[model samples]
Target: MINCDQTLSISNGKMKVAIEGCCHNQLEEIYKTLEHIENGENIKIDLLLICGDFETIRNTEDFNSMSVPAKYRTLGSFYKYYTGECKVPYPTLFVGGNHEVMSYLWELYYGGWVCENIYFLGYAGVVNFGGLRIGGLSGIYNDRHYDLGHHETLPYNTSTVRSAYHMRKYDAFKLAQIKQPLDIFLSHDWPRKITNFGKLDDLLHIKPYLRQDIESGKLGSAACEELLFKLKPRYWFAAHHHVKFPAIVYHDERTSSIYQSEEMNSKTIKNPDEINIDIDEDLENPDEINIDSTTSQPHISEDERRDQIPCTKFLALDKCLPGREFLQILDFPEANGQLEFSYDEEWLAITKATHEFLNLSFNAVSLPRESVIQSKIDPELRWIRENISQKAVGLVIPHNFQPTAPAYGEQQTFILQKPFKNPQTEAFTRLLNMSNKINPDGQSRPQE
Candidate 1:
């Protein structure tokens, strides 16, 4: 049995780690990487966030399908890869990929399935990394309405249904409703307009195919889009499209040129900056879109239980070889928030704190890599304007963490200019005061 607590633990002062998509049987890469890390550098990795697509099969029901061979063909293969090849170390966290979220939903709805050791964040949920709160929404499916048995008609497809069913709606809603703020957000799918590289399109063709699967649901989830626009986290990590390299998407701060021609206006895809705050894009009129989905039901061959639950089977692996783990270390005392790799407990604590703070500002900070932070004050001020002050952006930064100029190197401190007195500024002050008040103990508080 895998040890959930020590194996995949999250708390203050823990390591902040990252991993790309490991869909299906792509366990060899992780093994080789771990081996390389172990030999090349003595880094202790804390958290291994496999951003979606951990299952072997692209699309299939693991819940009620009787064909073990078919079922194992995908998830089974993935299972073997992890158990046999890469003994994943540290606490591995997973967000449901387009492939796995559906089956995961069935597993969650059905009672018998169990994923050992791994923390399966059901579509959306929040994880506490000590003082930091990392929230995520893994529900990204194209079909707005797919079939799931039981005869109870739902309004949206599995992903949308689960987005609301899981805690995403609440997370987005509460982020706006509350006076406090959340720290980090982990989403499998990037907000529709958040990336620069179309690289992932070829690398991870699954994401776009998944989008194609959703019947023109306006590109992406409006709820998720709304949260990104409104809450504006510190750092967000995602991997749906398997691009050779990761691209960062930052908020644009430039004034769009006025179009003189009407034809161009219609042809140009509206800049995401113009309409990110709108959540209405996600909700399809029930009349226009059929929510009474039966897609999964046809694939299911088992009889429904008295409780109306689908039957599921749990697989057990003997002496599972979890992935080799490493630690994410942040040198707070270094220039421009220098990030290095280390496993020391004391260093781990400081690194975790810095990571938590970074995650809190993921959406608001528009530079690549935390080390690029030149002026902490400037970023904090910019965050206030973009997120807190509601200022009109003049020069937008793309790829939240990626700096526009990589050669500039890391900045030590920032200069924040006092803005003209406005109602929003007052509101920001009120918010800061409120944060100080509730956090008398200095513990991070979730946005109500």
Candidate 2:
């Protein structure tokens, strides 16, 4: 039932969007690529979407938190932007991958500004830009840590650091509650069996080792696959495989039905033995725990379905390197009024309704009971309408950025700074009238 198509939707003015793959901390090269695209194509890009591996390392201490080998680690261009030493040429938005500073990302679990003009999508979130509903889930999917909570904290050890970025079920389940349409959706990894819809022969030529996994029907994230079918976005982009591949997800008409209730998350864990596995250090190749991913299930109107295909165009790019297909430029419809970042109403409502379910301890987190959550959404939506949407500032994500860590290469002596509450996260949570779960005591660090 799967097929291929390019056209999605269209309008008057065009919004040229550039999509990049794994940054690998290559900000200078990425900027050059963006420059080249604009010069060659003779069109200005409105936004830049980075898929992951964006190492936002502020100091040497932050570098120690990455999962990569010591030899490959370096304070890349993010620090320059963080220190006001350089300026970003485009509005860059990104999700997190395994190679990121997990401690920094964890501080903004509900999504906040990592740097000026650069936005982190948190663990899982949605935002609107220039008439595009962009939703993404940070980190790659790992079976062992999928069912657990955010138990990892600062000063990570070898195991916890690596597991910190693994995608969690709680975030995935929250994303499933969305009911509106997404113009574009991003994930750090490709959806499972996605090769079935794309240029498989070319993929096999580059990644011959992946053949065994692909044939065994275990190549990508099942949660992503479920969301792809359910959200049915116009376009889906991903990175992390280090391959430039295109796949079109054709949604069945039946699958277009929205998941409005919470019963869809009740899946039986496959193995009880894995249940007793140590909570901090994960076991490799652990037994699978399924998330019956529910989706808001956007109903595309006849006019919205370009060429009447009813398919989500999916493209996954390679990492930033010479001769690699790491960048892509696509056209989206321009904004009707102004092009700026705004918070999605339904996403905020979901956050408000489910904030009580957030777990930050080593203990395994439980999903909010379906009955309890089902009843809370209505009241939360009403609260959002009265408190957020009707506010003087409205749903525009505020720009309250401030440096919390030392500049990347400052002359100051090496002083390790532990994580502090991000001002952006504090402001965001305060706007929602929710308590700041990240730094409950409102602790902060002296600006270096």
Candidate 3:
């Protein structure tokens, strides 16, 4: 039996990936930077992962919909790619940030092509790339709306537009139910109290303003922290608080890997006492902590204690701009170079199983009781095994790219509101026989 510290299986060969921070629509500079790195190192980057703030502004309506001030709201290079004026050089995947055009992203809420070769990771999703089980949660977390269902519709008001990207409980809960291990997890916000594990002194040396938020435990996301503790992925990458910070989260107290880079400075940044970090109830729990509820994912076997250490290598990069450390290229030589993009069976089952409980109401509603959701999945799992698990190339993610909305035109400022539901999302939901909850209106449509 695999122990708690063990990760999911790797692929036959390796994959080269470039991880980018917030993409404030600086497409030219980002590609140039990647080319510079590739030429300098004499290597190729297979995939590009943008953490958030990708600013997929296609038209003037999208530009108007973005939650930015007047000066910062200009449409950038994304429209050229959307209109076939240019093509993305590499396969790119990104989550939504607060600064995204919610009109387009919500249309692809179940995750679909923004255009050819560019994919949105949905509100929360898990997929396989080069044998790495990559899981990502789009949008940021807000304490005020964390427990509420998605309430914002298109033609958003001042408040709804901002709350549109606020991470919802339904999305987070879906992610927490994942039993399969994740290799890489991308989140826009840093996990709360993450400052404790990394070099705090070095971090403060640059962003001194963080000290107050760090001391008060006000910075980072509680939802992210809870997921970090719960998932324990091999590597976690984030961006939102514009800074390049690295840290090591050790699952087993006794052991840790010497992850290179400057998470910890040469010797030490300073003594732990210098910056106060609160180690609360989450951290106090040991590696083999059990979920006691019916929804508990019992992946690790009984022979799990003390054979090896499990740790999540956490790194967060800065937004795209001059003079900021916003990109890093990582190589997964242990991955399966043979496999193309495939769907994760467990995630698909989880999605199908929990589709009924998918909430789209506009008010603060508590998540369906764990026992209720668990009961729903038990029967659905059998259907999944018989249908999804039995076909040839069954879990392969279909190259489903189509334009359901109008494209950016020359000098085209104002376009129509998103009227048609994204064809990609509609097809994906239809494939699983799940109800299409995404709509122009924030509320779910009546079930047939």
Q: Give lDDT tens digits, candidate 2, residues 1-448.
A: 1123323211123786778888888887788766765564466878999998999988777876789998998888888888778888898889998899886787788887887878888899999888788999988888888888888876788998888988888888888887788888988888887777665777899999999989997788888987888788877888988887775555755332231111111111112122211223211221232223365665553323423547677878888776676776666654443467888888888888888878877666789765677677768888888988898878888876787666656644544444677788888888778988876653365444
Q: Predict model 2's lDDT versus the native.
A: 0.74
Q: Global lDDT of each model?
A: 0.33, 0.74, 0.72
Model 3: per-residue Cα lDDT over 184-229, one tens digit each: 8998888888887777887899899999999999888888888898
Q: Candidate 1 lDDT, tens digit per residue, 1-448?
A: 1110111112233343534443343544454554454344454545555656555331222322221233445434344322223344544556655544232233322111122234544344554443444555664533232112122112234433333222233223323322234444655565553322223343235245644434444444566556665555544455554432222222233212210001100011111122111112221111222223566533321111111321111000111123211212221111222132111122112222222222111023222332332233344444444543353532121111111110111232322111112222222224333221111222121122
Which scores better on lDDT, 1 or 2? 2
lDDT score, candidate 2, position 369: 65
- lDDT, model 3, position 280: 21
The reply for model 3, stretches above 4 Å from the true place, is 1-13, 253-307, 337-339, 410-415, 440-448
What's the best-to-worst order under lDDT? Answer: 2, 3, 1
